[model samples]
Target: MENIRLGGGVLLLVLLAVTSLFVGVIDVTLQNLVDTTSRPQALQTLAESRIPRTLALVLAGSSLAVAGVIMQMLARNRFVEPSTAGTVEAASLGMLLMLLVFPGAPVVVKMLVAALFALVGTALFLRLVRRIPPYSPLLVPLTGIMLGAVIGSLTAFIAYRTNLLQSLGAWRNGDFSLVIAGRYELLWLTFVLAVAAYFAADRFTIAGLGGDVSRNLGLDYDKAMAIGLAIVAAVSAIVVTTVGSIPFLGLVVPNLVSLAIGDNLRRGLPWVALTGALLVLGCDIVGRIIVHPYEIPVGTVFGVLGGAIFLFLLLRRSSRVS
Candidate 1:
């Protein structure tokens, strides 16, 4: 049954990807690809724009989802993700500083700086959460959200003063419209990092059992956490540096999969990845068609949808606890 469902999800993703390819303002159909003269432009569009956009969607979506799984496991909180934990916000700040201080810095430099900030931000969040005296699980997410908001506000204020609000907004509201072959290659790094985390999934799952229990189980809990933070930081940094911040992706996708299939990362990772990719791609398509020539950012659509789901999950958890 799991295999069947996973297979179905992959098929659905392929269909959506095909839809993604042909849904832009400029018409690109099967016939356009076949016609002798039009084929050049059609092929160029597919090669330079549509295909890269689709790949970016999948890579960014899956990376964020997988990062969410790792983060939630390490934090032992279902609601925790990079965006919630100040990782993405920190990355955005790093990118903004990079933009202002060294405007000519290469993308890789910007990404590394962003990753450093993200790592520090995540470490601070985990530290704060740990020090708060064993409390409700809800406090974990609440703390993270608060930390993220603080970082986000600081980033916004900096951008406001520097007259870089437009660039900051672009990063804050992720849109794949400007993604082309060369422009979006950084997102592929996230795929590699996500795969690395998958190989160490058991360590994180064990670590979630708490420090003593994981150590008793022969896992290095602190080491696992450090590695997990790095992975999450790198993934968040790459995504934000490449496309911008995508709100609620890392939070919503993994939690939804866990609710459906249980918290085991090994078993649920595939579903999380697929669902994440699917939701982002579907939202992108909707954003394009919903307004014809004018397009809504994918971040806007997914932010609204994911925000609703986040509220639902929060309320449902609170009700169950009550």
Candidate 2:
């Protein structure tokens, strides 16, 4: 049954990728894709724009998804992803700072700033977790959400002060239309980070057991945590920088995959990556189809559906605990 479910999810994801190629703001169809004798403009658009944008989405989606799973394991909770844990907001703040302080800085410089902020944010969240009482796992995400809200508000204030509210809003809402050949290269960094994550999967699983147990097992708990935080930060900053803030890709993808496969990252990591890419691709396709000429951002679609699912899970867990 589990294998069947995984296989089904993979199939759905592939369908989404294929469908995405067909649907877009422009009138692109199979005829356009197949017509080798078509106008030069059609081929130019596909080769330059659509293909890179779609590939960027697939890469970003998978990277963020795996980052979420690693984060959850390190934090020992299913709900504490980068979005909930303030990493995305922190990265946004960094980007805002870059644009404000050094308006002419390169994209690479901006991304580095964002990565630094995200790493610090992840560190802060972990520090807070260590200080909090361990009895309630529910409080972890709650604390994280509160932290994110506070950071988000700060980001808003800065945007308002700098007179960059519109640009910041675009960044927060996240649109992939900006993705093109030169810009999309940053997203590939997430793929590298994901590969590094696979190598450290066992250590993450061990660290999830608890600091004392991890130490007893001869693993350096703090070092393992730092590594995890670094991975989360790198993956998250790249996603935020490449596309913008995607609210629930990190949270939803990992959780859904974990539901199908077990929690062991070694066993479940590949499926998590596959499922993550699928979900984002499918959502992107839906966004393109629903709005027609003007498209809704993938983040918005995920926000509506993902928020409802997150709420349902929260309520269900509460009921079970009580």
Candidate 3:
């Protein structure tokens, strides 16, 4: 059954990728690909625009979902993710700082700065989690939401003062419409981070068990956590830098996968990636088609759906507790 579901997800992702390639403002058809006259224009659209956008969707979706899994493992809370934990806001602040101070820095430098900020934010979140008593599982995510709100406010204030509020708004709303070949290459770093997570999956699964158990098994608990958090930070930073802040993607995808497949990171990771990619691609397609020639941002679509799912999860948890 699990394998069947996984196979279905991969099939769906392929279908979406193909759909995305041909369903754009500028129509691209197979005939155009072969025709000598229109071949240049069709191929240009495919190579420069559609291909990059699709790749960005896949990389960003998979990376964020995997990051969410790592975060939940390290935090020992299913609700924690990059967006909720203030990582995205921190990365946004870092990008804003880069825009203000270095203004001329390359995209890589901007991403590095954002990653640094995300690391600090994640560390701060973990520190707060440690200080608080885990009386309720819901408390952890609420605290993270509050932390993210604070960071988001600060980011907004900085942007306001710098007269970059409009620019900040654009970055805060994840949109694939602007993606082109050169612009989205930074997301490749996220792909590397995802690969690293796969290799380190066992250590993360053990770490999720708790510090004592991890140490009893001779695993370097702190080192594993550091590595996991680093991956989360890097993924968040790169995705936000390239595609903007995609709300609740990291939150929604992993939790759904965990609910379906159990907490074994090694076994669950691939499903999370496939599901995440499918969800993002599906949302992007819906966004494009819903307005027909005037597209909605993919982030907006996911924000609505993810928020509803998050509410459902919260209510379900509360009901179970009761």
Candidate 4:
């Protein structure tokens, strides 16, 4: 059954990707790639824009979801994700700083700076989590959301003052319309990190068992956590830098996967990755077709859906507790 579902999900993703390639203002078709008689413009759009956008979607969706799983494992809270935990906001701040200081720096440099900020942000969130009593799982996410808001406010203020508010808004609003061959390559770093997370899945699952358990099992609990945070930070930074912020993507996708499967990171990780990609692809497709000729940002679509799902999850948890 699981294999069937996985296969179906992959099939759906492939279909959506193909659909995405041809959905833009200027129509493109697979025939454009093979036929010498086809319009050169179609082939140019496919190679330069559509293909890169599709690849960015896959990389961003999968990596962000995997990052969320790793974060949940490290934080011992299913609700905590890169966006919720202030990592995304921190990365935004880092990018803002980079824009203010080194506006001409290469994309790689911006990503590195953003990632460093994310690491600090994740560390701070973990510190706050440690200080809080773990009586309610909701508390951690609420704290994280608040933390993210504070960071986001700071980023906004700086952007506003610097006359870069529009730039900041563009970065905050996740859209792939601008993605092209040269622009989205930073996301490959996220792909590498996601693969690394798969290999270290066991350590993450053990770490989720808590510090004492991990230490007793001869795992360096702090080291495992540091590595996980670094991975999450890197993924967050790369995705935000490449395609902007997609809210609740990290939070919603992983929880849905965990609810369907279980918290076994190794077993559920691939499903989480696939589901995330599918969800994002579906949302992007809807965003494209809903307005027809115009488009809504994919982040806007996921924000609404993810927020509703998040509310439902919270209510369901509350009901179970009650």
Put down candidate 4 lDDT per residue, 21-117, tens digits, no spaces: 8997886767775678776888888889989999999999999999998988889987889889999999999999999999999988999999999
- Clashes counted in candidate 3 amount to 0
lDDT of 3: 0.90
Cα RMSD for candidates in order: 1.1, 1.8, 1.2, 1.4
Model 3: per-residue Cα lDDT over 1-322, one tens digit each: 8889888888889999999999889989999988999999999999999999999999888888999989999889988899889888899999999999999998899999999999999999988988777676778888888998999999999899989998788778889999999999888888888889999999999998889999999999999999998999999999888889778888888889878888788999998888888888999999999899999999999999999999998888889888
Ranking by TM-score: 1, 3, 4, 2
Model 1, poorest ten-residue lDDT window? 129-138
TM-score winner between candidates 2 and 3: 3
TM-score of each: 0.97, 0.94, 0.97, 0.97
Write model 2 residue lDDT over 140-252, tens digit each, in one string.
Answer: 99888888899999999999998989877877776787787788898888898899999999999999999999999999999999999999998888888788877777777
Residue pairs in candidate 3 whose N, alpha carbon or C atoms collide under 3 angstroms: none
Worst 10 residues of 4 by lDDT: 26-35
Task: Give one digit per residue, the lDDT tens place, for model 1 in 117-221.
Answer: 999999999999887666678888889999999999999999999999999888788888899989999898998888888889888889989999999999988
Candidate 3 lDDT at 318 equals 85
What lDDT is obtained when candidate 4 is compared to the true structure? 0.90
